[model samples]
Target chain A: MLDQLIYLFRRVFRNIRQSPVLCSAAVGTVAVALTILAFFSLIVINIQSLAAHWSEEIQIVAYLEREPSPARLKQWRDGIEAMPEVAAVRYVNQQEALRRFKSRLGSDSDLLEGFGAEILPASLEISLREQYRNRESAETVVGRLRQNPELAEFNYGQDWLERFEAFLELLRFGAVVLGFFLLFAALFIVANTIKLTLYARRDELEIMALVGATPWFIKVPFLLEGALQGALGAFLALGGSLALFQFFLRQGLVALLSVTGGDQIVFLDWQQQLLLIGTGILLGLVGSVLSLRKFVRI
Target chain B: MIHLYNVCKNYQKDAASALHNLNFKIAKGDFVYITGPSGAGKSTLLKLLYCAEKPSRGQILVNGKNITRMGSSHIPQLRRHTGIVFQDFKLLDNRTLFENVAFPLEVQGKKRFEISNKVYQALKHVGLHGKLQKYPLQLSGGEQQRVAIARALVVDPLILLADEPTGNLDLEVTLEIIELFKKANARGTTVLLATHDQEMIRRFPRRVIALENGQLVNDSAP
Candidate 1:
């Protein structure tokens, strides 16, 4: 068994070395496919991380009725905090809320200030546990908070956040679709390159068949050749991905996205890089084996 | 030894049989020629001998083993005991003459040293020892044929089946290839060559088998 492997390996290496042009073409095809996967993975990671961060920071703000007693306000805060779904609770007094609201109004604060600081009611700022961060889950918590006597009004951008989540879901779905197409393109590219190599050796294949060479005797070298091509392509793709990310990051796309703070837009980390390369190798192997299946008979 | 018991091989639904009730026996060490025109069952007979196709009817036995009933996995094992050559010289263009000849031994899982030595010896037998590093395209038609012969004979197989082995060779090289087959036969190998070259076969009168439209027309010791 060891001897058979040795023979297969030697011939495989020799064939790859003999045709530098064909070998490089196969590798290039694999690398291009791998680069596509890396691009999608990068997008997915960023989208997922950003969504998680936003879910953590979002809170439902419940406003108190005018002239509510301090005892009632304290009781309301305690009740919200005691709920298992509520991770934390803060009471923003009417004056503080009004002051902050004016600052947000920028130059148009004079019209609101004339109405006095008491115009804005106190709000119960509620932060829910991370598990209740989904659109449906967050809405459920809002329903529970609305049944309070002290609360006059409530404001939570549930509609806007739901729309944003839907948009992000669409982006993720698009990325997945794009990813499959890229994988297919990469597979065909690699297979075609390997087919060209096989075509060049068609005569030899016949000779091997006539001489009763086992199917594996003929297939092992091509498969190894494909595997090597995949690995080489992976390396090339890694380089291409790095260069592309650097280019975009240099153009300040990462910083421009900081308005959506906590999204932390960036390229793939080391583990993700490894995954990209691994995927490339798998694609190359499948393409090569599939391409050669018809040509070799055991 | 080999035995064909009323074996008939057909290709398609409408096509006629390539071999019709072919009853024959080839004892060990027989050197015979399957002489026929194109589309006359010559290639099909060789294909069956190497287990490439099963008989549509009847059966065959090689060394008392029923090859027609044997599974696909056993085909390679049967082929290990046989060697084959083709008229177009099925030599791998990407492989060097040495690599091509060394292929059979490698298939046997022989050690590299053993393969190299046997391949060198086979090349020497075919008078291609000096051109081991040359690719098939770089060599002439005769040289390529010689490389194919070396590859077939390298495994020291018991049976050697040739499909129009000299159809494309010149007169001078044709005799050289015939001599190699004769020499291999003298070493106890059963040689069966398919050829339309009557003049060449006539010169080396031995056992001759004729096929016409899939029927065995004649079998006689020339």
Candidate 2:
């Protein structure tokens, strides 16, 4: 078994060496296909991270009708915080609200100089838990909070949040569809490339079969060739994706898309990177199998 | 031993049979010749023996096993113990003589050292051991045929089938190639050589099985 493996490896390398142009073309085709996939995946990954970041910062503000007694404030805070959907609840007094607004205005703080603390309503800032940060969950928590007579209005940017949620769903659906299409296309191109390679070496394969080579013996080398091409292509694709990602970052394209911050725009994580390469390998193997199914009988 | 019982082969549904119903048997260690004109099923007969082409009817038994109905997966197993040489040499032109000879043994999954040793011996047996690094195209026609013979005999197969192996060679080279087959036959490998070269057949006397129009016309064996 060990000898067979050794011989198989030798044959695979020898094949690659003898037909460097064809092998390179195969590898190049795989790399191009996978690079497109990796680039799209990087976009999806960054967008997902940005969405999670925005979701993490989702806060629902409940404006109090009148200044609550200290006891009542404590009750409201504790009650909201006790809810499973709520991560935390904090009471912001009129003075603190004005101070936050002034700070946010930065160099334009003078524009709010005439405004008094009473102009700003005292409110409860309700931050939802990670799982409850979506539009539906936030609305559910809002509906429950509306039962309190002391709370006059709730502001969680409902219109835009709903739109953002819809847009995210659409984006997610598009990504899935596009990802699968791209994968299928990649597999097809790889299969054809390997098929061409197979045709080029059909004579050699026939000779191998004639020499009493078992089906596995003849098929394994080509399969390994595909796998090696896949692996190399994956590496090339990742490198290309990384370079493209860095280019996008330098061009501020990712930063422009980022809601949290420019720095939050990042490449695929190691796990996702590994998954992309694994997909490449799988594509190559499947492609080889597809071509071999028709071309090789022995 | 090989046995054929009413074997027939047709290339297509409507085409005439390449080989008609025929029966014969050869004991182990027997060297036989399949002599026939072109389209006389000489190649087809050899092909059937190696399980390349399935028989349309009847049974073929190699060493007491019915190979006529053998599964495609088991064909390689039968072929491992059978070596076949072709008129075209079928050598990998890009590969060296050593690599060509080592191919069958490699298919057998022999160890690297064993492959190297056996390849050397096979090439040496063919009188081309000194040119292990030479490619098939680099060698003369006779030399390339010798490489093919070395590759065939390298596995030390129980049955050796040569189909017009010397069809491209001159008389002198054909005789040299015949001598190599004779040596292999002497070593107890059953040899089935397909040819129509009457001069070569006359020079090296062997049991001849003659065919015409896909039918066996004569068998010199008693």
lDDT per residue for candidate 2 within A1-298, as digits (tens), equals: 7766777798899989988988888788888988888877667776777778777778899999878999989988888888999988888999999999999999999999777899999999999888888888888989999999889999988898888778788888888899899889889988998998889888788887887788888898899899989989899999988898787642465556745445777777889889978987888899999999988776
Q: Give lDDT for model 1.
A: 0.83
> Candidate 2 lDDT, tens digit per residue, B1-222?
999999999999999988998899999999999999999999999999998889999899999999988888888889889989999999988888998888888787788899999999999998998999999898899999999999999999999999999999999999899999999999999999999999988888889999998999999963
| Model 1: per-residue Cα lDDT over B125-165, one tens digit each | 99999998999999999989998899889999899999998
Off by over 4 Å in 1: A1-3, A249-252, A255-263, B134-140
Q: Which pairs in model 1 have colliding backbones?
A: A204-B92
Model 2 chain B: worst 10 consecutive residues (lDDT sum): B103-112
How do the predictions measure up, each by TM-score?
0.92, 0.90
Cα displacement (Å) at residue A208, model 2? 2.1
Model 1 chain A is weakest, by summed lDDT over 10 consecutive residues, at A254-263
